[model samples]
Target: MKIIGIVDTTFARFDMGSAAVDEIKQYVSARIIRITVPGIKDLPVASKKLIEEQGCEIVMALGMPGAAEKDKMCAHEASTGIIQAQLMTNTHIIEVFVHEDEGKDEKELAFLMENRAREHARNVVDLLFKPEKLVKQAGTGQRQGFEDVGSLRG
Candidate 1:
């Protein structure tokens, strides 16, 4: 199945574009996309193509908690919950990545957040996207050209 995905870079804390895709590609083969809010709001042309032309089946909205305080349990708990999509109300996954202030560099923190969001997205896809679709695959599929999560290869 040809699928279009959307990852919102609304917050600057994490790499929403790449990080969101990292979680999804592990579960299915699809044409993933990442769109920034500013670009979408400012440039109608890009939004038209991304929203109208591409025909994204599922838009996985991604976000990082702003301000260290907001990154507490509240944001983390929010990510592991159900949320409606922005563009297509009934056809989006509002996935979020939240990091804790445990004394780590931005890189390390981002890594942890990305992995958490990736797994969280998987749960969303399995539970909501295609309930009957079997995703529990044997073997890593690494030798078969299927890279691990966070890979850009097709």
Candidate 2:
């Protein structure tokens, strides 16, 4: 059986990692490994360790960036680190970041967190089991949280 890894931050108000695991369970039979860290920057190392030490095939790194300039900067740095981890391991680390500013209220933010994490969880299933499903939708403007912007040609 395959193993999926989820690395999330405790700083996030919502439990996006649980949302992801719940979603993944609906579509796959793979074992899931989850690691919770204190902040976004800690995601990459945990993700790397999941792949290297825990033998995960793919990882989902989830975080929520606060609505502040410094938070945005930290998110960017975390993104860079996630990319580096992916390249170093030659594996996919799906970074799911829902900025606090994305929603106008707490309810909406929670919705975005669940929606984005679940959507990415589906993407992980597609990647591991049926990559052609994703290829079939390429350039179709598929957004995870908010409504898709739609294809430019359409």
- TM-score for all predictions? 0.52, 0.98
lDDT of 1 by residue, 1-154 (tens): 6565555545446665675577678777777766676421222233334545677655555555554664554454444332312343344444544434531667766766666666556655665567554354423332211235432433
Residues 1-154 of candidate 2: C-alpha lDDT, one tens digit per residue: 9999999999999999999999999999999999999999999999999999999999999999999999999999999999999999999999999999999999999999999999999999999999999999999999999899989999
Which pairs of residues collide in model 2?
Answer: none
Report the poorest 10 consecutive residues by lDDT, candidate 1: 138-147
TM-score of predicted structure 2: 0.98
User: Model 2: residues >4 Å from true position, as ranges?
Assistant: none
Question: lDDT of all the models against the reference?
Answer: 0.51, 0.97
RMSD to native, candidate 2: 0.6
At residue 61, what lDDT does model 2 achieve?
A: 99
Q: Report the number of the highest-TM-score candidate.
A: 2
